[model samples]
Target: MTYRMLALSIDGTLLRSNSRLSRQTKDAIEYVKEKGVYITLATERPFPAAKKIAKALKLDNVLITHDGGFIASDVDEPLLSRKLHEDKTFHIAEILENYKCHIRLLHEQFSIGNKVRQKNQLIARMTLGIQDPLYYPVTFVDSICEHLMENPVAPPKIQAQFFSAEEAQAASMELQKEVPSIDTIVRGERLEIVPKGISKARGVQVVANHLGISLEQVVAIGAGVNDIDMITQAGLGVAMGNSPEELKASADWITRSNDMHGVAYMVKEVFRKQLKVNI
Candidate 1:
């Protein structure tokens, strides 16, 4: 299919387990870029965190962050931004307080999280600081609901880190039932909440439309549940070897594990074949 765009999920698909980008993967992306294929990061991370990797990869295209709730190259200028309504945020935070978890509200410019119960965790303490150009700004308050009650923000995403998988599942279920306008994504004990119609597939369509391309001319690669729709809807959907069975089943092809340079292998092998190159 003469693919023109390569949409990649960041966390488990592009980065190795240790969060490092391999040289082979860098080369692979450059190779495809030389062939005129546009690359975009389809991630659940905020723009600053995602933008760091995009800058490292030297991608000039826009990124789909907050699980497609926000799409933009710069935080100040966004092509698309879908945030949880202020009233809904208030209700969601109120519901979250009923459970034991670390809550975070992700905004394009900064993030606000709760520090009520996570005071003992060292990492959590360090994450409370407001970072700037170095990292996305994040701050902590005693109560997210209280902060929201006073500040009243419509954030792109809300996250909760529960102590157990069971608790996470239960909270997710409750949120789903109570809030009909939101979508909940579970990754281990972390629950990510975003507004509806904010899947990576929709982000792909947004990027495609902006670039004057079609979904059939895109190659979607990912390794998580959030990526399932993007992988299925693209012309060529690739799942990493390390991906869960559900994602693997949805993929048109499965590449090597991220640690084994899966992205490098897939791009060189497939794009080379498409170009009819002997290499």
Candidate 2:
């Protein structure tokens, strides 16, 4: 089938292991765009962080960021945004406080969290390991629950970082049972909690509706569990070779890893035929 749009996940799919974009990948994206295919990023990052990547890629389409909670272009207002209720956000924080984790509340453009350096030092190390322009802007307060209680505003999502995958999974299971209204997604030791029904697939649907395209004409590439919905929902779902086994099992095709310019390989090898491009 013919494809008109491409939705990509930034962290593990587009960016290399060092969190930098390769020249071949950039050129391939530009080439696909020249062939009349629209491309945009769908990530768990907020707008400020995602915008930098979009700019570097020269993408002009609306981006699906905040794990599908916010969608907008550089020039336009957010076409769609889903925020958690203030009470729900506070309750989530309260529940998370029982675990040995660092919690960060995600706003539209920035993130705020409690100062638990000891608990989240590993996350800091992981963040420092990645290269420039991929980091999120974060503010640490003394008490995140108290801060939210005093200044109540609906945030799009909450992210928690744990030292071990077991801790993360346990916390996720408890949160899922206690807070059924929220959706929990675990990526290694990082757990993301967003409003129920919010996902990359839903975000893509919003983008598709805005652009007047069909779901069957969309292609999604990602490397994480958060991307599973969109991967299964899109007409062509691609998983990076570096992706988890679960993700690869769900994908229609598996390309090389992100560091090897998997996106470029997918576009040049798999998609070019569908687009009917000789170049």
Candidate 3:
């Protein structure tokens, strides 16, 4: 039962509690790769963060990043991208401003414009020993109106994340009630605002097309609502055990919790049981 490919999601799926892969998980993934399985990742994380994990796994593969907004082999130069229409991007910013909510706009490697200042508290909370906010210098948008009028090249922002999920859900629901065209969903701690019908599932399809792999041969795993599309698309959609019930219900299988080394568990199960590709 050899798999043509395996596309894993990051965050709550692969990386363990400390935001790092455990030895077991690392070895299991490496083992499957040794068995000639094509391994890749689909993540909402920007290329910078995604690449590090890819290299760590020694997968020697490209990633689908920006929730599938861009696909780059080097993670430096994208091969394909689905950017939001400029006017739509502008409206997104305006919506956030009108709602009196804070937002951040990502450019190439880091943020291009900031909607709100990054106070120490915000920075500390974002980092949370999981990531270094200082890894990339972020610019503040300051005035929402100014950014829209200036139209300073939105450049296909990877994500527009709100500070909190509940707040994002609430705000997005309100916006959609008014606009009826807005697409908003939680990705980890933030709510992602994108033009309707854009998602990691669409992103992975871009990657799959480039690789000549059909959805039937590509397995995907994740733990968040944002991951629903990808999970629904994969040949084997695996949900993390700790994921919300809705997500689990949508998955083909549920792996262990992230803290319990779930990624490693599934890596072993897939190869040993399902794929039957000895490692």
Q: Specify the highest-lDDT model's number.
A: 1
Residue 47, model 3, lDDT: 66
Candidate 2 has its poorest 10 consecutive residues by lDDT at 125-134
Error of 1 at 59 (Å): 0.9
**What is candidate 3's TM-score against the reference?**
0.81
Clash count, predicted structure 2: 0
Cα distance off (Å), candidate 1, residue 196: 1.3
Give the alpha-carbon lDDT of every model. Answer: 0.85, 0.82, 0.69
Candidate 3 residues 1-279, lDDT tens each? Answer: 346678888888888767778888888787778766677788766666677788888876767776676667674668766665666666666676755345655544765544344443333123212432345665565665576577645544424455566666776676667554446665545556555666788877877787787888777889887788888988889999888899999999999998898878887787765543421
- Model 2 residue runs over 4 Å out of place are 74-76, 117-137, 273-279
Model 3 misplaced stretches (Cα beyond 4 Å): 113-133, 158-167, 174-182, 187-189, 273-279
- For the record, the alpha-carbon RMSD of candidate 2 to the native fold, in angstroms, is 3.3
Task: In candidate 2, list every pair of residues with a backbone clash.
Answer: none
